[model samples]
Target chain A: MSHGVHDTAQARFAPGARVRVKPGRPERIAPMHLRTPHYVRGREGVVARALGRFPNPEDLAFGRPGEPRILYHVEFDQPPVWGEGEVGDTVLIEIFEHWLEEA
Target chain B: MAGTPLPESVELLDKLVAALKRRGVLVEEDIARCQTQAERAQPETGARMVARAWLDPEFRALMLRDGTAAAEAFGVAMAGAPPLGVLEDTDRLHHLVVCTLCSCYPRAVIGYPPHWYKSAAYRARAVREPRAVLAEFGTVLPAGVQVRVVDSTADYRWMVLPTRPAGTEGWSEEQLAAIVTRDCLVGVTLPVAENARIAA
Candidate 1:
């Protein structure tokens, strides 16, 4: 079994904890592959739940043994994500811990 | 015929394929076989899981607990696929799936995504304005019902366990499965029991 970071660390945020997606792209050695969507960048949301840790996809794309990152189901209200929408409607996204911070 | 070099992507693909074959790591037949398998596991494959979940309580619980095992119960192979997450739909909630960055779907459950799913327009508007997109698909949820747009990602895939339509009391699993269309599985539309009548 490929035991890695995902296996060792506890998730920083729990379900219902408010968090924010880190804004802007970080400089990196390898070309960035897809991870978080730009639409949700810098957006505020609550942790719907924590999911299993998997290899960081950004590193995986470059053929590296990417350390596992904690994945979370983050829920953003429609009003904040878009300029207009029903108040209660929300967009749920899967974000890794690295892309998130306590809001 | 050989006047111009092949398009860069095609040329690169040819070289890559040649190298893989030389290394005995891949073969042309494998690609064909994968395509065939993907085509076979279409919406119908998911319909079976949905219908069984609707008809059997224990099965529904099992499906919710472990989706991959649930697929295995139906003999659907899920090798090399991302974890399958089935979003449940109730009177108060509806789940819509999109890949804002790219088209990442539960191909094992729903087969290849439709052409429209990969369009840039869909990628942009789906998360921004899902209600309008749902309206375009002819599905209009009454006010107060929360619409949760599920953004499927590179490592995770999603599908909706659509709220089973009313007046389908005695329908067989096969008949129920028949109504679970691909669009409904995507949550763009709801399953319809067009022929079922509510018994008086």
Candidate 2:
């Protein structure tokens, strides 16, 4: 049910906004083409930049027009992406609008 | 075994292509054309882009701002492919790109992904232990430089714009590009000036 925010070509959550990956769909039971990695699910990060409107790859893979979604470059710290000491390393993952919520 | 067995995914692709062919949506010529195009998609385009960017700050800004446009400036076709994202390597930060889910690379600019890049080990360990991965590739970074791993998860493909090695001030673009290998753009290794290598 966490899929109704991307109404505009350029939807909510701009760059520099703190956001968390949404754990919307259950991956194990059904066949889904998801771009959000499980390691980042429900984790917090900052939006590095908006990558303009793109058809949801999940839908495109299934041969659908996939109503455009705003894609953003989300940057996460290395600690939560994995359990490790502070290495000062960070990760940047491209996530669609529907998979993210303003933190 | 004669060779490694193809995964079920390969069979699925075959089935999909067959279905499309049956429906007249795909043809043999299309596949041949694709193969030809794939042959042309080498890392040389990316290397030339990096070399030009190293010498021209304006091109570097354009590359960072709009990677597809920069690639197009090099005459690489950018018709239906996804946008490109160029991550710059600075004195304090290094970028290593991985597709955790699958191998999604900037094929238009940098050719196909390497075998190791698509392996499950690289995909998993790159995010979990990037520093270790770089070291295995013989890239030992100083402690001060931060390691940044980029996951090419969605629509935009990623490549690294490596820093120019010192002592190449008067080098031509072709000479500069000659040192930029596919691994350098992949962020596993760096382009070292021959003099620096010899001196070290």
Candidate 3:
């Protein structure tokens, strides 16, 4: 079976890569429909795993070709996210490559 | 007979369904069959997998490695569904599943998701304040144990394999499976031996 929407010759981020989520504008203010969570924007996390390549849902939702984007499982510290919790706790999100930058 | 009025979204969904029917995008018979399959789904499928994993180390390894294949080996059909990933809860770590974008779930294995799972509050709070969310569900983990909230996005779906509760040693697989509740699989609660009495 096909692994994902499109096959990429190489993955953008390898496992354990440190990356930061781009702090894009909120959906109400943004021009495009973004699938990344608002709360996670601007946050730093580690690439937990490479979840393969898939069509960018943000573009796909609008009936565009979507192209292929590398999806990574990123894990963030819970305390940094929630502001008062177990430090060991973490939140993991599947993010598209476009939403990430090397930290 | 009178009944509650359908929500605007429901009405919109009806229109969408009617449109799909007119366009032949969906057949009535197929919709009915799908509804039947959804209704027939049970948490027992996940329970069986968890029970087997608990009993056999090799099966547990397989489940951790490839969840979909392990599930199919046990006769759970996963056709047309996204890939399945099983998260194992250890002594130091716990895993919770949520879909912030929408209510994407492992319907093939766990059946229909609970209504609360699809709520905006859950989607928002799960990523922002998961500890509080879990506390609201009566799952207060110890301070030292780490909680990991996994977002189900794109082509992968996740389920939690909760750590086996105490006081159930030497129990049969059937007995163990009895205590494995849907909430446990969702990572919101732990299976208790007390509840197993009723489940048995």
Residue-wise C-alpha lDDT for candidate 1, range B78-156, written one tens digit per residue: 7677778788999999999999877888789888888788888788898888989999988999767899999987566
lDDT of each: 0.83, 0.86, 0.83
Mind giving the per-residue lDDT tens digits that candidate 3 earns over A1-103? 2346234346777788899999967677757777787778999999987767877788778898777778878998878776876677898888888999999
Poorest lDDT segment (10 consecutive residues) of candidate 2 chain B: B191-200
Candidate 3 runs further than 4 Å off: A5-9, A26-31, B1-23
Clashes of 2: 0
TM-scores of the candidates are 0.88, 0.88, 0.88
Q: Give the range of the ten consecutive residues with the poorest summed lDDT in model 3 chain B.
A: B1-10
**Interface C-alpha RMSD after superposing true interface residues, each candidate, one decimal:** 2.5, 3.3, 2.2
Q: What is the TM-score (0 to 1) of candidate 2?
A: 0.88
With a 3 Å backbone cut-off (N, CA, C), the pairs that clash in candidate 1 are: none
Give DockQ: model 3: 0.61
Q: For candidate 2, write residues A1-103 as lDDT tens digits.
A: 1222223345688779999898755768888899899989999999987777777778888897787788888999998667883468999998988898889
Chain B TM-scores across candidates: 0.87, 0.88, 0.88
DockQ of each: 0.62, 0.56, 0.61
